[model samples]
Target: MIIEISAGAGSPSEQIRDRVTGLITTGALARGERLPSVRQLAADLQVAPGTVAKAYRSLEADGLVVSRPGSGTRVSDQASSVSPALARAARRLASTGREDGRDLEDVIRVLRAVW
Candidate 1:
């Protein structure tokens, strides 16, 4: 799972929080998926370790990432699911991005693929 912390997009913490949350919400990162260490992710994104740690702390508080002693942080089971609106919006973007540009067929295709 890639966690990007864009400095200009939002408060560093909020950007980190949103990116991680979005991944979980979109199912790009599955339940129990291990996350990079704070030091590692911080170096990768060029953000301060405190920023990544803050985001990880926020995620843990939200019941999204669980940290175990000696083991890495993992995605919580709660992240395996998302709210209906977000799920729908993600499908809409993917379905609409096709060459047909979001016709009923696209919707049906998404429905079939999902359902």
Candidate 2:
């Protein structure tokens, strides 16, 4: 469970939400997998607990995760990852980017331009 925060990306909560969303969509976070508690993630990320909570709430609203009092937050069983073809393409792009010595921001910039 790794989540990196970028100061330039957006608000802390938005960055968390986006990263967690990517993890779930990329199948890095499996369905029914439990997430770190809000406090735990905040502590790990050195952000406010409210930031993590906001991100979790957004994920819940998007149907990517579910939370319960005692059960904590878990990836929603109904949540689905990207299509196989897309995943393969992403992997290829990532590999190519790495080989070309392109950083993540560079790759993302190219992707945005292409989009």
Candidate 3:
């Protein structure tokens, strides 16, 4: 799973939590799939281990993931995925925006305005 941390966005922990949540809900991370260990993801993201741990704790609190001593973290079975139709529409929007020479910020701004 790829998680990007934007300096101008929320805190590193929040960004991690939100990104992982999005991945789970969009079916990018399957149910019962193991997430990177706290240390591993922290090293990958260049954040502290505590940051990834905090995000994992938040996800656990939200019932979106489960963490065990030996198993690491996995998406919870109850973590519902977004409908395929909605996922398709999102991909379509992203593709169309890129094809139209629009940057991510531009597409996000339009999405925000529409929302």
Alpha-carbon shift of residue 44 in model 2 (angstroms): 0.3
Candidate 1 runs further than 4 Å off: 83-115
Per-residue accuracy of model 3 over 16-43 as CA lDDT, tens digit each: 9989998988899999999999999999
On a 0 to 1 TM-score scale, where does candidate 3 land against the true structure? Answer: 0.78
Q: Rate the local accuracy (lDDT) of all candidates.
A: 0.81, 0.95, 0.94
Task: Give the 10-residue window scoring lowest on summed lDDT in candidate 2.
Answer: 83-92
**Weakest 10 consecutive residues of candidate 3 by summed lDDT:** 84-93
lDDT of each residue in 1-115, candidate 1, tens digit only: 6665554667887888878888888777889999889889888888899988999999999999998878988999776767778788766666666656666556768768987
User: Over 4 Å off in model 2, which ranges?
Assistant: 83-85, 91-115
Off-target runs (Cα >4 Å) in candidate 3 are: 90-115
Better of 1 and 2 by TM-score: 2
Clashes of each: 0, 0, 0
Candidate 1: worst-modelled 10 consecutive residues by lDDT: 1-10
TM-score of each: 0.69, 0.77, 0.78
Residue pairs with clashing backbones, model 1:
none
